[model samples]
Target chain A: MVQLGRRYGTGPSSLAEIALDEDLPRAYLEQLVTSLRDAGLVVSTRGAHGGYELGAPPSEIRMSDVLRALEGPIAPMICATDDPAHLLGCDRSARCTVNVLWVRVRDAISGTLDSMTLADLVPARNITLDPRDPTASPAGVA
Target chain B: MVQLGRRYGTGPSSLAEIALDEDLPRAYLEQLVTSLRDAGLVVSTRGAHGGYELGAPPSEIRMSDVLRALEGPIAPMICATDDPAHLLGCDRSARCTVNVLWVRVRDAISGTLDSMTLADLVPARNITLDPRDPTASPAGVA
Candidate 1:
């Protein structure tokens, strides 16, 4: 996603350019672009000046969507997934000990990813860093 | 990690039991157990009643360690890992576009997992599922 974003930031870039820039193999990137295109995340152009561009604005994309496109479901535990749910056959589903915690973590992760859009990740303005206080006490630091 | 945890949950559950319970394959579970035992997360005993058990108390173990033991590093971005840092070689180290965001996500995941021990997950108290209200919002319901 970052590689694509960076390449697109300088206007639409070819798969070859992106592959070289990201140090990923061009053959691998071709398949990746096809998947992204299939997901409607990227559009491809044919001919001499042809390349790839964001199918929609970067702001509209979510990291989770990108991840799911590249990888499958973002499940930490197989049991937490709904595409093929009830993966674990624990007899005591109503009171399974670790299931609840895994569910919480999976939900939290999904929620966090869903809450963030690509726009949140890439800003239009020049980025700056927040200054850190070297003299600040570590007392309250978590 | 849950699969591994189920395999080492202080029981005589066989590898087949763990795999069947977790909806994983016997061969895959076997490889995982070997890795876990090598990492000292589980110990194997011999005999008719022999099986795997937690090498350390659940409270003493962190999810980060378990995940690392099972998988590789928890780095979301290649550049944000200790194994091979600065993978992207971006000019702006302080203002890299995507690494910072991935680092935050990685930290959030690690922090949350580290805060939760297996003991916290497997409480003595039984879990109860609130009756589903059809009219209630999904966000507010589960």
Candidate 2:
């Protein structure tokens, strides 16, 4: 998604190019791109010069959205799912004590992913260093 | 583990009692208890009065430790696993861009779980509220 977002408006990039560049399987990319297209995260063009591009701007696409498109909602456990449909089926939902912990975990993950955008992950962007790491250096500094 | 921790130092709680109280299957509990016993998280006694108890205090056992003992290391993906045995087999470990994202997610989850001890999950310790909803009440509060 980030790659598609980066190359957005430039031209459609083929799955072949993306798979080779990303070192991922072309077949996996085909399946994943189908999901992305269905989720409206990526738009596909069919022609000799056509391929795939982000459905929207890089800044408009959040990691959470991309993750959800690929893997469904960010559920650590089925019982901890945010979707009401999933929650309806858990027999122990009313009395499960540990479900709270799983929910918190799911939220923490969702929170982190939602906080990041495709723009933030784009290559050549500013490096984010850990403030607690005294030995850490900036991206380009020697 | 929570049940064992809750029953810590009181007396050995039988697998049957724990399974019944937790609404889990007895056979599943047996297998899980075996893992817990092997992991040294719980100690078992022999004979008719035999049962299990936490090897340590509730506060001494973190959720991260319990999860690791039960589910193995918390890897969001095989490529993101902290276990060297798993990492050694990943051919794309060197150049996978998204491995960084998975590692961050694993770290976030580990940080949350590691920060919490079994004591934290014990009912009636503290009320956890949903930060997103100002109107949200604590778990039991009206």
Candidate 3:
């Protein structure tokens, strides 16, 4: 997502290029991109100068959304499905001792993922020490 | 763990009994008990009346420790292994854009699990309504 964000407006990036750059299998990337496209996270173009691009700006795309699109709901346990409706499938849901714990865990994970955006994962460039701060530089440096 | 905690001091409970009560396969329970015993979470006894019991009190055993013992470290991603050494397997550790996000997620999950203990999951016998809170009772209940 961060890589696509970086090259968003430049042009659509090919699956081959993304796979190569990300060091992921091209076949896996193909399957993943199909899901991403289906989820409306990315759009594909056909013909020359065509490839894939984010459906929206990186900042607008939360990590939670991407994760859900790729991995389904963030369920840590079979009985702790992300949807409350799914809990009905578990016979012990009415009195499951550990259900609450799993729910809390799932919520914590989902909350953290939701709180982050693709923009947050974009690497900062040319980070330099604060010259005005006396302790900014290492002992061996300057 | 909960079952063992509930049965603590009531004499060691056999795998067959625990499996029947928990509706889990005896074979599966046997394998799980081995791991639990090896992790020092549960102790076994020998003889006709021998079975298994929690190694420690429920309150003293955090869910995080049990999960780690049974499932290994709670890693949210391949690059976000709980052990720093395992991160070396990922070539992009030096500049993986999503590594920090995954670490935060892993921490959030671990924090939640660590905060809960076996005591918390032990089924409450009788949950009473808050006397000061009128809405605490069910709609049809007084």
Best by DockQ: 3
Per-model i-RMS in Å? 2.4, 1.5, 0.7
How well does candidate 1 reproduce the true complex, by DockQ?
0.29
Task: Please write out the lDDT profile of model 3 over residues A1-142, one tens digit for every residue.
Answer: 7778878777799978988888889899889888889999999998887899999988899999899888987898878878666554578666568888988999999999889988898765334477566654322353
Tens digits of per-residue lDDT for model 2, A1-142: 7667657667799999888778789999999999889999999999898899998888788888899888887799998776666664478766567887898899889888887778766665334477776655433343
Worst 10-residue stretch by lDDT in candidate 1 chain A?
A133-142
Expressed as tens digits, the lDDT of each residue in B1-142 for candidate 3 is 8888877667799988988888899999988888889999999997888899999988899999899888877898887778666655577776577788988999999999989999899875445566776555422242
Clashing pairs for predicted structure model 1, backbone only: none
Provide the overall lDDT of each model, using Cα atoms, as 2-decimal numbers. Answer: 0.67, 0.80, 0.83
- The full ranking of all candidates by TM-score, starting with the best, is 3, 2, 1
Output the better candidate (1/2) by lDDT.
2
TM-scores for the candidates: 0.57, 0.80, 0.84
Candidate DockQ scores, in order: 0.29, 0.43, 0.77
Q: Which stretches of candidate 2 lie over 4 Å from their true place?
A: A23-25, A125-142, B125-142
Rank candidates by lDDT, best first. Answer: 3, 2, 1
Question: What TM-score is obtained for chain B in each of the predicted models?
Answer: 0.64, 0.81, 0.83
What is candidate 1's TM-score against the reference?
0.57
